[model samples]
Target: MQPVVHIGAGAPGARIRWGPSPRAFGSGLALFALLAVGCSEPVPPTVTEPKPPGLESEPRWLTFKCVKPGCDETLDVTIRQVGARKLAIKRVVLSEPDRTEYSIESELSAPAIVNEQFKVSVRYRPIGGPVKGDVKLLVTYTDASPEEGEGRIPPGEVSVPLLRRLVGEPVLVASPARLVFGAVSPGESRSLPLTVSNAGSGNSSLVISAVDSDEPTIGAQALPALGLAPGSSTEVQMGYAPQAAAYSEARLLVRSAGDMVAPVEVLAVGTSLPDPTVAALPAEGLDFGRVEKGTQKRASIEVVNRGGAPLELESVRVVGNANLAATLPNEATSLTLAPLESVEVMVWLSSETSGDIDAYVELTTNDPSARLFSVPVVGMVTAPHAVAPGSIDFGKVPKGWVLTRPITVQNEGWGELEVKGLTLVLGSSDLFTLRSLPSLPLSLERHQKLGLEVEFRAEAMGPFQATLSVETNDPGGRFLEVPIRATGSTCAEGCPLENAVPSCVGNECSIASCESGWFDTDGEPENGCECSEIGNDPGSSCQEAHYLGEFPDDGTSQTFRGILPWKNDVDTVTFFAKDAFNWGADRYDVRISLASADPSIRLCVYWHETGNHLSECYLENENCPESRSFQRTGTGGGDDADYVVKIYREPGAAPTCKPYTLSVSNG
Candidate 1:
């Protein structure tokens, strides 16, 4: 059997025995009892803190590099420890994926102890590593005592996300390297489109920090936020405004966030053209020459644009004479014109009063040089009056025939006038009477017409004469005279022929005029007789024939001699008539002694077609003895008839022939 023995714990090489002698047992018991009383509990084991491997007592900054192509990202880190030590550290390790993708530039390993600042540098093999996952450091430390108990520091892990610096800043690429606005006009603006794109790879996000222009005339603006995605584009509008006419330039600066050391510069260039010029076609003025009163005239002026830019007309107006007016394109408002465009303006000149007419038309425009322009208009006005035919006559008519003639009086002045008294003056007042006499003091305005009528009655077989006197407020005269003459005779037997010699018929004296107003000094009938010293008087036949072309339709009159002193003394005249219609009483009228000085004269109408006497009349006979003038009217056989007027003294008791004037006329 083995015996056990106990000694003091502090004793070195203490032993326990099984079969020891009684003497040894007795001695061990005594020692054990003494040692037991003096011994105490044993002390616990010491603990130590854990730190990063090979990184303890160093600055905590850790650096990492992004190894991606075109990527220059870096990461820095600091390691630290906290809390009371309670567990033992096993090792310090990096997360699995992070450890494979990133490499630490500094020396750091597991199971390391760190009590102060240290530095650790890490590099990312791929650009995506820093942005994707977190690389963590695991710190494992123990606080355990062999003699006391198992006590250790708690396990700790720190995760740090690597920051991504992305690629080379916001790599902005402009579609066009320069901005250009071609030719521009002054007071105008031009714009062009600018495209900015981000051209970067990996996890790079681009941002446009700013866009600027150095020139005041140039401006730039971007739509939405300046930030853009990889391969994304943003548009910018660039504007240019030129103040003067010349070439211009500017610099457009663009800046982006991140690693760019300098901003992008774009050149802007433009040119400004001159403004438009306005001018009129007539360098002098528009003239509306010679316009009468109460008349209107027109003139035109052309407005032209002669510059590189548009010209605008603001307004147009007339500045002179109240009678003047103007019309222009868009007269009430404004008119816009393109380069080299033109328009015409119309001007009117009028005169309400009698005088020279003048006016000016002014135009307002947007031309730089000739802003305001004018044109002139000129004209003249004249006065007015009117005069009618000199006389009215009712031609020869048979006894008891009545004839009427109309006389038209026109007012030729600009104002109204009055016609006063009208009366008949004759050797026999009852011979001529007014039929449709206008009222005395009759009113007539400018361009107005009035008519007066006078009638002649051939009640006797003799020549008669009378005159119509009219009084009016005319500038020429207050009194006007119209002669009336005619010869009246019976339709049967024609007129009585005078017989100067008892042996010869008085008709023999109607032969050639050597027998008229001529005496043979030798008293020889065989030789040609010599003319008397007395010439034909004014009242006697010697005057040119009066035109009775339209007869009564065109009223006319003629005065001639109605006297025959010697035997067979005669006066002859001619006339043409368009128709065989009656003028007032007849188509043809023959009046002898229109002055009422002699009523014994005879009037004969001889037709050229027959070469014979058509009619003969002596208006003063029988009940017409008081009548002085003779009137006889008759119609021809056909249209366009020609007639001859033979006026002479009628053979009677009185041997001496009285010189007298006669008239042939139409109503």
Candidate 2:
């Protein structure tokens, strides 16, 4: 046991057992207590933040390699934190800007790497220079810890320089690779030439193939099978003949051996030898005998190919009847048939009938023209047959024209109806023609219709009556006779008229007047007074003779000779009652003119009362002052002398320029 030592209490600072000095032993005990405190005290351990593994602080080793395009390469990079801990960095920048360029995908990498493993990798893209791309990598590593040595980690960089090369692009171009020949007909042969040209800087091969128009027997020829040199060309020739009208469009497929195969079109045309001709075939058509009601009968037609080449089939298109069908029965090229080969075509008849049936078979083949041969198919239907709206009615058609009547022939019958001949009869001359319309060979199917347009033109307006006859395969309506009435015309010009003007030259008179100066209406005779015979100027209301620029007949169709006896100086006057410019014709009419281009002269006459006030027998004179206004007085439109005008060559005493009070009448 140890004793406490304190000076103030019982001991100075230490105490020990009595006897020999225990100071040394006491001090040793105190030392032992201190050591125990130091060893046994619970102290919390501190966790210090680890210092990130730092990159080797040294000059960076950067290498450049120029590849394609062979541009000189250099680098430029500024080391900002060569000595600083946080921003410490070493770089190599491109010095020659023309040879190298640097681009970072993000702005955060502009200054420094995000971590030690982050780096920018560069490679040559060969686009006229050394191209640079960026690469950022993340790696795991560790530094020396207090208790543990450094562990192995992936060696990487935030961004690292990587010298790489991009492949160089080659020059390429497209060339024609395929050839096609359009459509070719039968009996006609044509040839097409194919030329191949190399448009690329490099050479290429062409392997052509036919696509659509493949005629096995026909052969083709092409030049230069190996290929075409750069900027060179080759040609191919294809020939074939079509027995019929056909278009041969062949597709040519070409392969360039290495690059590509292009397709092109080659079109060809072929002509045919007219379709099969059956000159000796039955013209009466096929005869299907004893067809019971409600049963179908089929007839087959045998045709022989008489042309030079094999029979090339165009088509076996059926016309008319839905119940009746016609077919060649096989699906093969028509040319497979040799010359003089006979083929059978079947015509099916499925309409209701009790007697014989007729079916027309049309055969078209390698010939340019094909003839139509008919085979009669018999069929009987148990149900009844009828026709709706089958009659054609022509309403009031004018004469001298062809009347066209279009009618819809509806099949209201359970059995198909066969219509044979439809005709317009009763005085059907060359002027009247009956068109049977588009011929529908077989049945009038239920709800089926046939269009028939019939024309009747030769109509004359006098109650024309005639009958239209129609014949069909229907027993009841085999001969349909219907009445067709029309009105005919007798007069070509208009209707007849009464009191037409009759001309008479023996007395030189027409109708109510006589040329001997006598009028039937008036009884008396005069020198020149068949009043109505002379025409007056309509423009001028004056009663005067007119000489048109050309001659005009006053009473007859014949032209009257020029006004003789009156010389150029004499005035043969024509009066225009209306003003030419203003064209104003007053009811009183005032303007007057001379038909003759001469001066005005009045051949006057005297009048005095003898029997009545003016006697025709007593007033006979060749000259006098009695005259009417003859010439225009001024621009005001009246003659200077209101009634009298002196003769043109008066010489001695002139006739007075005054209006005489004597009256004159027509010529």
Task: List where candidate 1 sits over 4 angstroms from the true fold.
Answer: 1-159, 165-171, 182-190, 200-206, 223-230, 242-246, 258-262, 275-667
What is the lDDT for 465 in model 1? 76
For all candidates in order, the CA lDDT equals 0.56, 0.39
Q: What TM-scores do the predictions have? A: 0.21, 0.18
Instruction: Write candidate 1's Cα lDDT for 533-580 as tens digits.
Output: 245422234243332333332346665543454555556555554434
Angstrom error of the Cα, residue 338, model 2: value is 59
Candidate 2 local lDDT, 1-667, one digit each (tens): 4453332221112334444246776677667677777578643444667644444311132334554343545433222221123332233233333443333232234334434333333333334322233321222222222243335232322223333333332222323333333333565555666565545442222333333345442435544444443344556566666544432334434334444444444433232333433321344555555444656777776655544356655556455445566767574323345544556766676754433333455555545454343344433343424454434444443345355555555555545566665666757533345565775455665567666655566445545444556566654567656555444333222211122222333422234333432222222121122322222212111233232221111111112122122122222322112222224421222222222232333343222212112111232223343333322212433211112212232333332222112121111
Worst 10 residues of 1 by lDDT: 495-504
- Candidate 2 Cα errors over 4 Å, as ranges: 1-381, 384-395, 425-431, 489-667
